[model samples]
Target: MVTGVEAPLAVTRVGVVGLGLIGGSVARTLVAAGVDVVATDPDGATRAQAWDAGVRTVGSAAEVLVERPDVLVLAPPLAALPAVLAELAAELPRLVADGGPLPVLTDVGSVKAPVRAAARVAGLEDRYVGAHPMAGTEESGFAASRDDLLPGCTWAVTVAPTTAAGDLLRVLALIAGPLRGVARVVEDATHDAAVALVSHVPHVLATELLNLTTAAPARALALGLAAGSFRDGTRVARTDPRRTQAMVAGNADAVVGALRDATRHLDALADALEGGDDAAVTAFFDAADPVRAALAEAAAGDASPRTETVALGEPGWRERLVSLGAAGAVVARTGRDAITLAVPPPSPK
Candidate 1:
């Protein structure tokens, strides 16, 4: 049964499938929060590290399934998702015969829709939920993972029509209850489209900018002069190219649309620069001022977020939750009768 928002996470154990940066950080974070974590990764060195962090390390996904964790987090690379799902499907029969409840399966994939489709094909859709944490370094591997990554980050918890209300609340327990992070509920399609503009296109732009800088005629001069903008834009470009490529491919349609829009804007800016249109250039920055100021205000925490109770269990409550997330509010506390959300801080006028 769902408890008050402030109650400790009742989940006895969480099983993580891949102990890479995202998964490793989750395992460590849960372990630190006093949750028992059992995980499996192919790399022995990575498994050893997770074991040292107090997580019980297993040899494979099937072993973890046998252990019957309350939540099973699938964190393999996108390309590995199909095979991983297949293995889980094969392991299900053995688990079900024990006459115990199955784990609530979730994933930390960047794109949500494709992962949902794969899970649907494997017949795991009923119990599956999509989650994408809006935090992570460009770095990969278990060694680079930090338990502290969970706090203050927003986790986009995507759900479909078939998702159980109880299952949804269970994931929220992990995100808000123990991890001390924001839980934003969105539909799978909404998540893919929004993340494309906010995440994938930026990754592409960062990589292209780094390439442009590398091939410059005065490459050494430019490298020596590079500062905050250059460094910040290209930070995600330092990620392992292969993984980034797969993430982009997983959401190719949305990324393509976002890229075309970006290109159109860039072309207009280039035209303005070439013509030396001072007025046009000034207009561009002038229009962007509010967003810049709003972001600054957010960073400084100048405006405190407001809170109120939003009722649940109505016929259309799930859709209401989606509206809350799209409106920038995060679920602050979930209860049996209602959910309390913290409305986003005000934007600068």
Candidate 2:
């Protein structure tokens, strides 16, 4: 069972695969916090860099299982999951032959259900948990990684019907405990759908925004006049296009729904402006005031946190955590029989 203590983190050692921005950051950040960390990347230079930063290096994904980390966090790109998952499975026998239990399996993947499916294929789903730190940059590779990325970020840690409460709490202990972060215990589908609305579709729209600027007849003038708003809106388009493509493709179904919703909203706003319906325009903007306020509060980092209890000793615990996450509550501590949940202030409607 996990305790409610904070700082110096509960997870003492973590093993990571793929030393790209997210994985590299995870290894770097945990090492900075005095963790005994081991990680691997295909790029030798990346492994050397992680070693320079005080992280132990492994030669390959299968070797990570040999190290027998308490938790194995695979941080590969969306397209690379299949290969790494296979690697982990191939090493499972070697790991267990030594009379050691498999490490808690998790990943930093943006999409969830597919990862779970892949884990099942590898026969590793029994120990698999899914987690996504709601933080990243328009950058790729270890060179662009930083230790500061995950601190205070809300991790969308996932739960499934078959998940053991203890397994869920182990991942929570790492994110919410020593790492000093908060997390939502969400269902995989729920996480995919919500992130599509907030992340994937926005990436698409931002890329489109950048594309529009390039095609404009006044391109040079507009480029010269581009200000903070334009930069802020389109910054993600600056990410490696292939990486962005993989991310959006990984969550295509939800992204399609969100994209159509965006289209419908744009169509309505255009109709209102064309008809000169000032009232309709006013109502349209008013309808999103709450979303605007919520985003503002989050950006400002001013929403104070308060606590509520989530019972973990009872049946339907997975469902309970899912409901709390949907309500925007985060697990602050997973105690012996309950989770101390930190609920942020309600967004104004």
Candidate 3:
């Protein structure tokens, strides 16, 4: 009987088990939407912040479950997800009957496959849907949380066959109602692969760039003069180092694959430069022009969603182009069979 203008579903209560940026934002949004929100965090400061913001605070995950919320969001670090899910599974049945069970569970981890595997190991896979909301600030913690952070952003929802449809819809409703966008359903593998290319690999690359610059005395003046272009380019590198390491390590294989592909692109570019063929350079620049244009269009919200069909033809060419686009790289069709995708040139590292 949850009745409110913003409440899309009958979720009377929601539990958020980590009052960090993502958790705090979700709790605040639900509370503002007229849903009861119970939040927990091991850090007393975070809990206090949530309480100060008008959310019901709890001592632990156990107490949150005692409320038997309609949904539970595990918003811990990516590496901590396995242990958290395991702990939740152990305490779940006691809080609610097996028939109704505890609340449907989901998480805001950056990676998915590992989290899904952890849920399976914890015996809570059926009730959980892996979600990656593509929104964040460089900031972290409860103080940095914002209710409007998720609006107009794309959230990837990964579901397995065993995931409850009702539970998934309820979660989606919460997101759409308060966050103001539809959750894009994607396979766990596809979601993980795409994120590895765009988010994960870039973090590593940015860190490498920063590290190389810091190590070189010759680059001191260059680093000082680094402007909007450098700042924007290396923005993700400014993320929490520990968190970045955890994300990159947790999804090692995919990140490594992306890095290798990126290396190949760099080698090719170097070879072209060494050869000093004006025609080759011109062709490369011409092909790259469109991708740069497309990226600008995408940033300006002008790029239409083109449903390009992938048919079997060349072995690696089409896939490479598509991967470029998926990685937030600029890709444009040069001709019928030929296409060009711009790669971000390697920095010092």
Candidate 4:
């Protein structure tokens, strides 16, 4: 049985399909936790990397399922999830028909509604869980994988309506135990909406910012004048285009809504400045000051292993918590009216 998380069963072998940044890290972390990991990647370099790291390598995701690991983590790109789940759905019952145990399957995808829907359509709803790790650098591929990548990160887990409690707890055990991440359960649609605003839209905005400056006649001059602020804002523009496109496409409505809201805010700021409304301008910048402080305060709390819950309200709490560097502060669950944040406790001296 898993210890701290109190899972009903022990997970000794984990199968990881796809050895990109998230998958590679899962392989590395499971190995470090003394769990045998069987992984597959189409890329020879990534398969070799996993083999070198002591994880058993396989040729394809189908092979990983044939092995029937205790748990299988699907870590492929967002666009690839549907087909993969369908394949797994077909493969799983065959594996279990022979009286062999069926492994619990989970995916580390950014958007959830599409994946969950795919799983439902494939008749794999009970065995599948949707998860997103709110962690990663601006880098991709196996070379960027690190065991420490997930520590203190919020691993958002979304359980479909038909998911079994045992399956849910097992995923939680894996996330909280080996990964050293805080596991929080959220619904599928809520997960999609939350990520669209915070991650997907920001990535699109960064790409647009880069495009705006580069397409201008003064491009060379504009780039030369760019400073830390500009570089920081445009950092995610470096993300893999295919992956970003998949995210945008999967959550198109939410992305468009977020972008519209952002446009309105920008217009309000412009109107305030153009009209020479000193009070309005001051209020605009001043409103963001608390968010910055909230972030700093949250960051200071991450040195410890405790958690604090904050009821998400009125739009600025996420900015404050994220700014504080408390990666543990995440949307644990969302209700009709508000979200519940799992804030990490302050560190000890």
The sequence of per-residue lDDT tens digits that candidate 2 reaches over residues 15-94 is 99999988988888888888778899988998998888787998998888787787899998767888998988887887
In candidate 4, which residue pairs clash? 295-320, 295-323, 295-324, 296-324, 299-324, 301-346
Looking at model 2, residue 215 earns an lDDT score of 96
Return the clash pairs for model 1, or none: none
TM values, all candidates: 0.90, 0.91, 0.79, 0.80
Return the lDDT, model 3, position 228.
Answer: 91
lDDT of 1 at 206: 92
RMSD of 3: 9.6
lDDT of 1 by residue, 1-349 (tens): 1123453437778999999989998998898888888999978988888888777899999898888888899998877888888888999998888788789999898999999999998888998989999887578888888889877778899988998877887788777766677788899988999999888888889999989998999999998999999999999997788867887888999999998987887787888999998887777668778888877777776356787666667788788888777877778787755667777765656
RMSD of model 1 against the true structure: 3.1
Best by TM-score: 2
Error of 2 at 87 (Å): 1.7
Report the alpha-carbon TM-score of model 2 versus the true structure.
Answer: 0.91
Candidate 2 wrongly placed segments (more than 4 Å):
1-10, 295-306
For lDDT, the strongest prediction is 1
- lDDT, candidate 3, 47-157, per-residue tens: 887899999998988788778888888998766677788778878877656566568888888888888898899998988887778877478899988777766666777
Error of 2 at 337 (Å): 3.5
Question: Backbone collision count in every prediction?
Answer: 0, 1, 0, 6
Where model 4 places Cα greater than 4 Å from the true spot, the runs are 1-9, 302-349
